[model samples]
Target: MEIPIMFEESDAVEGHHDGLVISLPVAKEHGSSANIIMLDTLKHMNIDEKNIIIKSTMLVGFSGETKKTSGEITLATYAKGVNLQVKFLVIDTLSSYNIILSRPWIHEIRAIPSTYH
Candidate 1:
């Protein structure tokens, strides 16, 4: 399914609560830059501040607006019998979703994220 992001669209998926977040391998590599978690989400997740990698990266939106990353952290994430050590890019910017699961993680798990609404 195609998800609209800015003027362009990304294969990146933001799932709803009821859908199982498991992935099946796909050949496309479109969402290489997906899977971002807001810093606010990280705060509630109880992650130690020491674990944040200071080497920040810059992310450009579909509309060409860039968002500078705050930091990064690799978490031992488990979902639907899948254990993935997910490295989440931390962003302090405002967004509607807590996390956008995509790319390597999606391909690894074969994710078909739940309906957006």
Candidate 2:
């Protein structure tokens, strides 16, 4: 089995959005449970399929070789919704797991509230 290394979610929110973050432990030994956890997480988060983006980061072995992969899926191809932006972040570890889901928060500048004397 393969394990995740890191998973994090930002407090970002948008229209009709779904986000998933998953992390698993890394092992010096090969064949960890991380891969399975990642797949399961993806399956669980993928509601429409078209609007999902899967970003995966993997670190393995005693040498700690890290790999990064990303892909985008469109729910429209599956006859689901159109232009939905669902983000998925997966990290594999060898000992632990972490998962987070949050809306994509956008930062904007606004004037401070005026104080009355």
Candidate 3:
């Protein structure tokens, strides 16, 4: 379900919202190497479908279980007054966390997970 928000169409994608801020809940994994997002979340956010690249990825879980990915997408994500173009591996993991911010994101943000939390 899409959360209702009032904003100009141009400001929505431009990051020039003049102080508009939106919050999205997600999980962060310091141990994980790559960022991952639920396929359903991509659809709900109206992202990844238009510019998704067909690339398969193999992921090994903490317990050594494996999952194959369907595709990947690079999107400009805004948070805390910062705009970053982040890459996310797409898969139907059905996780409670729609997006898992991992090492790549943590490093990009120049933040230590231990201290961040």
How large is the C-alpha RMSD of every model relative to the true structure? 10.7, 17.3, 13.8
Give every collision pair in model 3: none
Instruction: Give candidate 1 regions above 4 Å deviation.
Output: 1-32, 113-117
Q: For candidate 3, lDDT tens digit of each residue in 5-75?
A: 44455433443334322244332221178878888887777664766787998999889999999888876
Candidate 1 per-residue lDDT over residues 1-117, each given as its tens digit = 977634223543555355544332111111245667788767766666677897688988879998899888776666566766778788997776667666667668665443542
Tell how far residue 34 is off in model 1, in angstroms.
Answer: 3.1
Candidates' TM-scores? 0.65, 0.24, 0.64
- TM-score for candidate 2, please give it: 0.24
For model 2, give the RMSD to the true fold: 17.3
* Deviation in Å, model 3, residue 28 alpha carbon: 20
The Cα error of candidate 2 at residue 31, in Å, is 25
Q: Give Cα distance to truth, residue 41, candidate 2, Å.
A: 0.8
Each model's lDDT comes to 0.65, 0.32, 0.65
Error of 3 at 74 (Å): 0.4
lDDT of 2 by residue, 1-117 (tens): 756434234432435233333222222111032222343444555443343466555545347876453443322111112222323344333323323222231111111111120
* Model 1 clashing residue pairs (backbone): 23-109, 23-110, 23-111, 24-109, 24-110
Candidate with more favorable, higher lDDT: 2 or 3: 3
